[model samples]
Target: MTDSCIQKQLTEPGQEGPVTVSISRQVMPGCETAYEAWISGVIEAASSYPGHQGSNVLRPSASTQNRYVLIYRFDSYENCQNWESSALRGQWLDKLDGLVQGDAEVQRGTGLEFWFELPELPVNKHPSPHKMALVLISVVYVLVISLNLLLAPILVDSGLWLKSAVIVILQVLLMTYLVMPRVTRLLRSWLFK
Candidate 1:
């Protein structure tokens, strides 16, 4: 983790809401299997902690080189910090001495801001508020319009409020799980510029 624990201090402390921490680790050549095993163990250990929501691992791909990006979520910053600062986590990290290369790159964010993170970037940088807002506006517009058009026939007999509720729920789900990640990745260069 290197000085990432220190880096966390650079960001706001005690931030409310779900806290997401992205950890990027470059696995040494031929250590992929061992790293995977280690991941399973650490994830299980982390899951035992209070407020540990879950984790998703983005394995190395051509674009990501050998880096494995682990996204860990907790209910709040306090819980996240507890897990981060735990001796258990330290022990797990210490076991990585020979399994990976260099220190892990870590970035922490609250709520929607995590979507805008660029894992490959060395430093934690967020898109300007205006840029983020613009991209979000565009995404919401497209999603809402497209969803309405596609659902109109099926929801024709539904009441206005019912239809609106459905659309809103679907819109949020798509935005969180599907559309946003891809859009953020695609427009990262412009968004971050």
Candidate 2:
């Protein structure tokens, strides 16, 4: 396959930029903590590498076979590759010889280390997903409230505090009960092995 910087790559008929996610499992016994620490290092170290966008680490509520998901969102396939083969991670991978399985993504895909292919996402400037999700939810709620106010001025409540409180409560309930589960599910796929 051809490797090219995603930003410079022209959009092709059937090709799309990828948001690659890796789901790897530890092979040797008693190295779960080491594996996680090493993967976490890889995620943090990725920021220094080219095309590095952002990363998320997922661990199951209970450990079974020692699995972890490392979701690295990159600017392009080329950037992901640059991060993968860099000296920044060489030692980390080498350290995995007796800890993690030799095959990077054995059960995650046919053979590739990556699990899922997402349409290219613009690099997020936010350091936290909660912040990003909150901002988006807030903006959408504001738009809906504004439309309601325009339609019926009488519904505008007496106290802004009360209205704001109501919104906050509703958002919290929705987020806790509805949103977090889906995020957990998406991250869990990385441990299919």
Candidate 3:
């Protein structure tokens, strides 16, 4: 009900072959560490069960209600369900029964089942400066390298390695200032909440 019309329009509710599931949870007032320990244990144990892609824990953002997001990316839809229904899963869920407040909401995936034609994209279409900046930098690098070869001798003679050094410096600064912080912020947002 809180979702926007555009959000609804863009999504189709159904299972594709393989999908990641997100289980969001709120830590009981003082149970943050305990909640994490339990979930981490489950993640380690899931390896023996097979079909588990991996788990990403998201801490709650200031705007969000839930405090934690447990994202379990499964290799397949069936595999995800199997993990949910498995005996080990039951044990894990049982351990958290009263430790966390409210039931968890599991989002099947980021959308797009992924096939030969449509491989998985590293980042979703969210407003990610990290991804976009990287793409732009890559294109610029290709153009610069191609152009550099033509002007190579003169530039080299002029001690132009400094230009390349400047670019590398800029890259590191941008990554540190603009990209990595936001990424880790969101990553920890998923973890600590």
Candidate 4:
């Protein structure tokens, strides 16, 4: 990767929850096959790391040598860090040596950010409103059932406003860091199509 591409680090602060790291790389003119091999190796290595969730790759367009975007997900920041700091990751990066152009552009965020965009597409290309509503309803149903079961005793002793506030907070946090990511990915075929 080019020096310019290496400017930003993979994970930033507040990324301790379920996180998705996007690595954008410009493959050399004739090294597509080599780059794919490197990606497979990296993914295999990452899958063995603690807290590893899953990964997705956006291949370059058939008509152009565009950048390839690799999205890797992990269950927690500590787990992601362990993979990033490993000698195995370093070796994989080293293996890419001259197969890619400049340094890779890395971005990190909690997984919910991907819910709005169809995987392998530009960020603005969102899923249909109907599909989004379906997903939202499913999530809310799960959250309500879960919260009712887990917080029944606490809610019975709390004021109405306090109960509402606590429930909302829990719903938002759970949806953002856990539920949405897995749901969106699980239903990608229907959500995107």
Show where candidate 4 strays beyond 4 Å: 1-16, 62-65, 117-193
Please list the Cα RMSD from the true structure of every candidate, rounded to 1 decimal place: 5.9, 11.5, 11.4, 10.7
Estimate, for each residue in 77-162, the C-alpha lDDT of model 3 and write its tens digit: 66777788899888888898778877665555433321101011222223244544554466457555655675566556566577
The model with the greatest lDDT is 1
Q: Each prediction's Cα lDDT score?
A: 0.86, 0.52, 0.59, 0.79
Best by TM-score: 1
The digit string of per-residue lDDT tens for model 1 on 1-193 reads: 8699777546565556799988889999999999999999999999999999889898998655568988899998899989999999999998898899987877888866776766666556888778888888999999999999999999999999999999999998898779888998899789878
Work out the TM-score per prediction. 0.75, 0.47, 0.51, 0.55
TM-score of 4: 0.55
Model 2: per-residue lDDT, tens digit, 72-114? 6666656666766778678766777777655544221111123
Residue 120 of model 1, lDDT score: 67
In model 1, the runs with Cα more than 4 Å from the true position are: 1-15, 152-169
Evaluate model 2: give its lDDT: 0.52
lDDT of 4 by residue, 1-193 (tens): 7766665435565454687787888999999998999899999999999989889888987522378889888888788898999999998888988899897767776544555543355544557667888789888988988897899887898888888899899998788668887887788788778
> Which candidate model has the greater TM-score, 1 or 4?
1
